[model samples]
Target chain A: MDTRERLISSTRELLWERGYTGTSPKAIQERADVGQGSMYHHFRGKSDLALAAISRSAREMRDSADAVFTDTGTVVDRITAYLRRDRDALKGCPVGRLTQDPDVMADPELRRPVEETFAWLTDRLAGLLADGRTNGELDPRLDPEATATALVAVLQGGYVLARAAGSADVHARAVHGALGLLTGDARRSPSGQENR
Target chain B: MDTRERLISSTRELLWERGYTGTSPKAIQERADVGQGSMYHHFRGKSDLALAAISRSAREMRDSADAVFTDTGTVVDRITAYLRRDRDALKGCPVGRLTQDPDVMADPELRRPVEETFAWLTDRLAGLLADGRTNGELDPRLDPEATATALVAVLQGGYVLARAAGSADVHARAVHGALGLLTGDARRSPSGQENR
Candidate 1:
């Protein structure tokens, strides 16, 4: 990979693993195996590099969601596929994890991508739910905006539960719980593999 | 407060603000206005003191939930009270936040209280849900444990969204969303003050 690509990927990994405050420029350099001159040549500094990384992470998040969202299926089916997608549950969401970092939150430039990711996610999901309601697939009275927010929260919060317990089972259970509530049909959304 | 009490409280705040890896022994001593001798005399080290603070935080979490969970109301009503309770929404959950701290998650001792807090929370909510089912207050087919897990995740994930956006409104929205779903009544949960 080019030095810029290497630096951005390293920053992304560090941001996910250590957070903004915990991750250092020197660490980024070491991880990317690029010298300080190379890093500076590619970007202004740590914050600049982080922004690039975060924006990339946010784009990736939306892309993955859209992958399931735009697929051929009923709205509920698509939403379920997105929720149950294979993930490193214990490692947590790359974009969602940054919310806990004080440094990232203090800087709006740093926080923008994180905010945009969720905004876009909920907006996209809400649109899908609205389509379902219009087509008489979901309850007419369902509040798509609020329900969409809740669905996104379940995925983010499921990671929190999974990490706290040091087990992915709790995360899976949380997802199924949400699916049960949304679908109003537990039999169809049976709680699958505990550790998957 | 006593020296020991001061140390514990200070550690609790630091853990919440800075996390395990970010908080240092010197920082803790300075925050508590105690010297190294006093700090070491009161506890073994950062880990032991953190355990005490985390356990205290866990107890407080349960106490606050019980305050709502045990209130005289229908199961859904009690759950709603807990979800809608006023909070430092942007600051995130004290116990749940630790789940993101790598140092805390890596150590069994540090992680125990966090795990127990969530386990107790989900278990307690599950019991309340089961009661709702038995008493004909909720759907008989509802899976109490999974539903309980999802409810807790909403709260945890709500903080995530709130922090990311730098607004408590999203957290409140997520709460009402879940409440609406669980109760299947959105009108009763008319979206409240956006800033509240």
Candidate 2:
């Protein structure tokens, strides 16, 4: 990667791993294998680089989610595909995790990507649920906005439960648990790996 | 307050406001009005003091939650009360916020209180829902464990959504959204602030 790409990529990883307050310019320079001169040449400072990184992370998150969202399948199947998609349960959601960083939330410039990403996520999920409600598969009266809010919260909150336990099973439990509720069917969503 | 009490209180406040890694020993000493020697005399170091602070926070969290859980009300009413209880929505959940601190999650000692607290919470909530199922107030076939998981996620995830948007409304939305699903009555839970 070039100096700019290296810096942005490194900043994205650092932000995911350590958050904005914990990540430092020195660490970024070290991780990116670039020096102060090159970093400054490409960006104004730490916050500037972070905006690029945060925006990149948000887009990456949404794009990955959108793939499953827009893919051909029953609405339940697509939503399930999105929730059950492989993720680093222990590491948590890169974009969703940013909400915990005081530095990020304290600055609107830094917070925009995070905010927009969720706005898009809720809207996208709401749209999908609305489609599901229109079909006979789900209860016709299911509130799309409320249900979508619950689904998004399940994923983010699942990360919290997983991290707190230092185990990934709780994360899966939360996901399948949500799938069960949304499906309005009590059958356990196949763990896909019950042995684990 | 005594030096020990002051130190614990200050650490809890800092943990709630800034998370584990963002808080420093010097900051703790300054906030607690205790010197480094006094700090060490009472505790080993940052990690030790943090354990005390985390445990205290967990106990306090449980005490407050237990009041609602054990209160006289229908199961849905109690759970709704727990979710809608006045909270520092933007500041986020004190115990739930710890899950986001990588430093807290990395150390088993530091992570235990958070894990135990959530474990207790999920179990506590499941019990309440199971009671509802028995009383025929809620759907008899509702999966208590899975439903409980979703409810807890809504609260933790609600905080994430609200913080990302820099507004408490989304948090309320997530809460009432879950309540509607849990109640299975499908009426919008009043935000109580329709005026806003």
Candidate 3:
């Protein structure tokens, strides 16, 4: 790969592994196998390189989500597919993890990709829910905007819980619960009793 | 406060504000106004003092959550109270945030409090939902453990989204969505339609 590409890829990996604050320019230079002169020639500094990397991560995140959202199936099925998709639970979401870094959140440029990724996810999910409602696949009373927001939160927060306990099972269980709720199976327990 | 107390308190604040990797022993000393010798006298080093601080934060997290959980109300009401409780949304959850720190999660000693905090929360919420089911206040088909896990995730994840967007409104919206689903308000769209 080219020096610029190598630098961006290295920065992305470091950002995911060490976060923005913990990652250093020297580390990026070493990882990319590019000297300081080359690194500076490609980008102004760490923040500039980080912004490029973050934007790339943001686009990739959306593209992957879109693959599921646009796949053939009912809206609920699509949402389920997205939630159940394979992931590196311990590593957490590349875009979502940036929110936890004080430096990333402190910079408007750095924070924008993270912000837009979520906004896009929410909007995309909301659209699917609206389609479901129109087709009588979802409850007519369901508020698309609110429910969409919640679903996104579930995926993002599942990482937090799973990481804390050092267990992937926690993440799976949380997703299972959210899916049950969305699919209406969670309306009643297995004992066959109805909710009032 | 005594030297030890000041040290722990300072460590807690720094951990919350700058996270584990970003925080330094020197910074902790400066913040607590304690000498290096006094700091070392109280604890082995940064990790030891951080453990104490993390444990304290974990306890405070539980105590605050318990206040709402144990309050006089129906199962749903209590859940709502917990979700709606006022918070500094952008700052994120103390224990939940630690899950993002590589150093903290790398060491089991440092990770215990964080793990225990989430475990306790999931259990407590599960207990409440089971009670609701028994009292016929909730749907009989609802899986308490799963639903409780989702609820905790929503709160944890809500902070993540909010911090990303730099707005408390996103967090509130996510909570509203989760509550609507739990309360059965999200079963349909606002036009008064029903799901198939």
Candidate 4:
């Protein structure tokens, strides 16, 4: 890749693996295999490079979600696809994970990508749900905005659960649970008992 | 508080605010107002102190959640209470946020409290939902395990969204959405129309 592309991509991976505090400019330089002079030539500072990386990651996250959001399928199918998509549960959601970093959250410039990405997801999901309800695919009683928001939350929250549990099954279970709710199978337990 | 107590509490705060990699022994010593010898007398190192602090924090999290789970109310009311409980959205959940820290997730000992905390929450919420289903307060078809998992996911995910948006409102909205689905209010949009 080119110098700027290499730097941005390296920054994204470093940020994902180590977060803003743990990720250093020197580390970025080393990872990208670009010298200090090249890094400065590409960006003003660590924060500037971080902003570029975060913005790119956020864009990628939205694009990936949008693929499912606009895919040709029933609303439930689309939502399920979005939720059940394969992921690196242990690593967590790249954009969603950034919200946990104090450095990223402290900077408006750094935080904007993360912010806009979620806003876009919530809005996109909301629109799809509205269409589903209008077409009688979803329960007429469903609140698109709320349910959409909940679905997005489920995916993000599932990562937290999976990471904490050190297993992807927990994350999958969480996703299945959310999909059940959206698909109107809310009353059926995976094990065939209500409480048990 | 005693020296040990002060040390534990300070470590907990640092872990919450700075995470494992970001928090240092010196920082903890300063925060707790204890000298090197005192810190060593209380605990072996940062990890040891963090374990004590994380365990304590996990217990407190469960206690706070239990208050809502057992409060006098209908099942939906209890669930809503659990979701609506006051919180510091920007800071995120003490245990849930740790999932984002590579150092914490890498160490099994350090990860135990976080894992147990989420596991306990899922089990507790599932039990409550099963009771709700049995009591005829909820739709009989709702899967307790899945629904419970969904609720927990929403809370964790809500924190992510809220932190990303730089506002608690998004988190609150996500909760309301989850509650709406649980309460069978899913069909209604906020303005009584779709796409508005």
The DockQ figures for the candidates are: 0.80, 0.71, 0.65, 0.72
- On residues A81-186, what C-alpha lDDT tens digit does candidate 1 reach at each position? 9888888899999999999988899899999999999999999999998898888877777788888889899999999999998999888888898888887774
| Cα deviation of A19, candidate 1, in Å | 0.9
**TM-scores, one per candidate:** 0.97, 0.96, 0.94, 0.93
lDDT of 1 by residue, B61-166 (tens): 9998988998898998898889888899999998999988888999998899899899999999999999998999887878999999999999999999999888
Q: Give the candidates in order of lDDT, highest first.
A: 1, 3, 2, 4
Return the lDDT, model 1, position B30.
Answer: 98
Question: How far off is each candidate at the interface, as Cα RMSD in Å?
Answer: 1.0, 1.2, 1.4, 1.3
- Model 2: runs farther than 4 Å from truth? A193-196, B193-196
lDDT per residue (tens digit) for residues A15-108 in model 2 = 9899988899999999999999999999999999999999999998889889899999889899988888888888888898889999999999
How many pairs in model 3 have backbone atoms within 3 A of each other, for residues 3 or more apart or on separate chains, i.e. clashes? 14
What's the CA RMSD of model 2 in angstroms?
1.7
Q: Which pairs clash in model 1?
A: none
What lDDT score is found at residue B26 in candidate 3? 99
